[model samples]
Target: MINMKRRTFLKGSVAAGAVGAAVSAGLLTPRVVLAAWPSAAFEAKSVDSALDALMGSHAVESSDKISIRAPDIAENGAVVPVSVTAPMSNIDTISIIAEKNAAPLTAAFKLGKGAEGYVSTRIKMGKTSNVIAVVKAGGKMYSASKEVKVTIGGCGG
Candidate 1:
């Protein structure tokens, strides 16, 4: 009787270990995965082209709802502080792009419900360029821009 109980306990432990391993390997996580590959706006040559690719041929209007804050003159082009804020509700995402930089797209933020649509980060500017904030709201695109002067050359400008 003792030998039988030991065998049964060992079998149960092995089964539990296998189930735990599977669950840890994403077998139990509920994930809604996207099928398509993510698009890259950074490699695009022009702002319009990057916007077109990002917005998918949709018309984007300039709006005051989105505000882009950056220094008019950046003493150091290597790292320029930039911030974007959207006053509107239901903001899906916020993307920051530098027009004249070699890689246009600097950073992107995906906003959640009840979360403020604001992002601040340092971006490298090759030269004086327009820093654009593209906000996605109500399945539409809106943008605003501010020109930032990069006095000290960064990115070999």
Candidate 2:
């Protein structure tokens, strides 16, 4: 006779519950299970090229309505904090572009219904570059950018 222990199915359920909590708290964006991921857009080398691939023929205008809050100087090129906030109606997506990175597009957020038009995340900077925040709302694209100087030590004294 052999005795087998019961599987920890509750543990898996707990993890799923945690993900639900994160979605409710807006900490993480839930992705469509079978949605196709955009590889070419994120793999584009230049900012303009990436934008063209993502937004097609649409014009991107610089707007004061979009605010990009990033450190004027980032001590580390490996991790730079970036945040974007816009008080606009019908926001569809927000994308963060690290202008000088090998792959310029760093993060793209697809805002769901009732989700606040704000996104904050840490991105890698290959060197000193302008971080641009692009927002799509009401069939128009608005953008803002800030230059962040990367330091050597990666930790300010």
Give candidate 1's TM-score: 0.69
Q: Estimate, for each residue in 1-157, the C-alpha lDDT of model 2 and write its tens digit.
A: 1222123344534543554454457453323421456554565556765665565423689998888999998888888899999999899889999987767889888888998899999999988899999998987889999999988674772
Candidate 1 Cα RMSD after full superposition onto the native fold (Å): 18.3
List ranges where model 2 is wrong by over 4 Å.
1-35, 155-157
Predict model 1's lDDT versus the native.
Answer: 0.71
Q: Which residue pairs collide, candidate 2?
A: none
* Candidate 1 clash pair list: none
Q: lDDT: which candidate is best?
A: 2
Query: Model 2, 9: alpha-carbon shift in Å?
Result: 53
**lDDT by residue (tens digit), candidate 1, 58-139:** 3678998788889998978888999998887898778898977755767667787788888899999888889989888888
